[model samples]
Target: MTVQPIVFFPDQRLRQVAAPVVAFDKSLHDLSIDLLDTLRAAPGIGITGPHIGINLRVVVLDLPTSDAPEFYVNPEITWLSDDKVQNEEGSISMPEISAPVERPTSIKIRYADLHGNIHEGEAAGLRSVCLQHEIDQLNGIFWLQRLSSLRRNRLIARYKKLGHA
Candidate 1:
């Protein structure tokens, strides 16, 4: 496992649509490990392939106090609840400001594991938020995008002032 550099906002690669894994190869497993390593080292709850400019549909995450991490490959939302909870969220890619964004408290996700095994998981609370956030990154969307226009503008201004955008 190796720590990979995270790409910041406005990077073209972050907006690139990622390619899905055709085979569960050793390279994909290694990449997941690296992403987990980077996420842990950065002290972040999650990280995506696009965040590292890999343009691959992969994401890794662990809850705030969880020691066990989970990896998702080609993850997609299978179902979502209409019930939403607004949580203050931040990202390693943009550390300047955290804003409240509403997301489902529970979600169903389907993905292939490192071993080429397909699985489905139900996530609620922080796990749900983390899943949605990372999946958004795969779709070229950021958590900040969930904020209201005014808040998003304010955040961008703050990030610009901090020289992080």
Candidate 2:
């Protein structure tokens, strides 16, 4: 597994919707491995296909409290709790100060496994956050997109100023 370069914010490609994973092919498996490698390098909980410029509906996640890597393909949130709370959220692309955003307390998600088997499960806490973050990528949305327009603009400017845009 090799670490893939992360596509940072302000890149228009980040705003493009990812395509669904059609089959469990060699390339798809390789992408998943690379995503795990990249996520480990980021020292973060999750990584999405789009972040590595793949534009396929795949994500790799490993919470700080967990060691086993989790993979999701064409994942969809099937349910969400009404209770919500605000927390500081960060991203591989932004790599800036974590911005506070309100998100559901829990979510039930469905996705295909590496072997092309469908699976559904509930996730809370960091896993939930990771799921929501990665799912947003599948739809061409970022965590910062949940922020106010002014704040989003400011963050983009900051990234540009940092020479990462």
Candidate 3:
């Protein structure tokens, strides 16, 4: 697997909503592997197809202490708890900045495995945060968009000063 180049923020493709993966084939499997490799190389806990310019509803997550990475194909949040928590979220596309974003404390999600098998699961804490973050990417919402206007503007200015934005 190759560690594909990530598409940075402000790229038009990052704003485009990802298309759902329709075929469960070797290409899908290869994309999953490439995503995992790219995530590891980015040294991030999670990544999605859009990060590497592949606009498909795919996400690869390697939460801390997990035995292996998890791949979600065409993931969708089916339910979210009213209870919310604030967590610091970042993205590989915009590596230099992170801000606290409020999200559901727990969520029920439906997604398919690489083999096209459907699964539903509940996630909480960091796992839930990561999933929500990546799903937002799949839906064309960059993590920075989660921040408030003041915070987002400040972060963008900081990013620009750092020569990354």
Candidates' lDDT values, in order? 0.86, 0.87, 0.92
Question: Model 2: residues >4 Å from true position, as ranges?
Answer: none
2 or 3, greater by lDDT: 3
lDDT of 2 at 69: 89
What TM-score goes with each of the models?
Answer: 0.94, 0.94, 0.98
lDDT of 3 by residue, 1-165 (tens): 899999988897888899999999999999999999999999899999999999999999999968999999999999999999999888889887888899999999999999999999999999999999999999999888877889999999988898996
Candidate 3 lDDT? 0.92
lDDT tens string, model 1, 1-165?
789998887677776778898878898988999888888887788998988878899988877667788888899999999999988898878876798888988999999888879998898989899899889889988777788899899889999999886
TM-score of 2: 0.94
TM-score of 1: 0.94
How many residue pairs clash (N, CA or C atoms closer than 3 angstroms) in each of the candidate models, in the order given?
0, 0, 0
Per-residue lDDT for 1-165 in model 2, tens only? Answer: 799999987687789999999989888898999999998887678889999889899988887778698899999999999999787888887786567888998999999998899998999987887789889988999888999999888877877887877
| Runs in model 3 lying further than 4 Å from the true structure | none
- Please report the candidate that would top TM-score against the real structure: 3
Superposed Cα deviation of residue 133, candidate 2 (Å): 1.0
Off by over 4 Å in 1: none
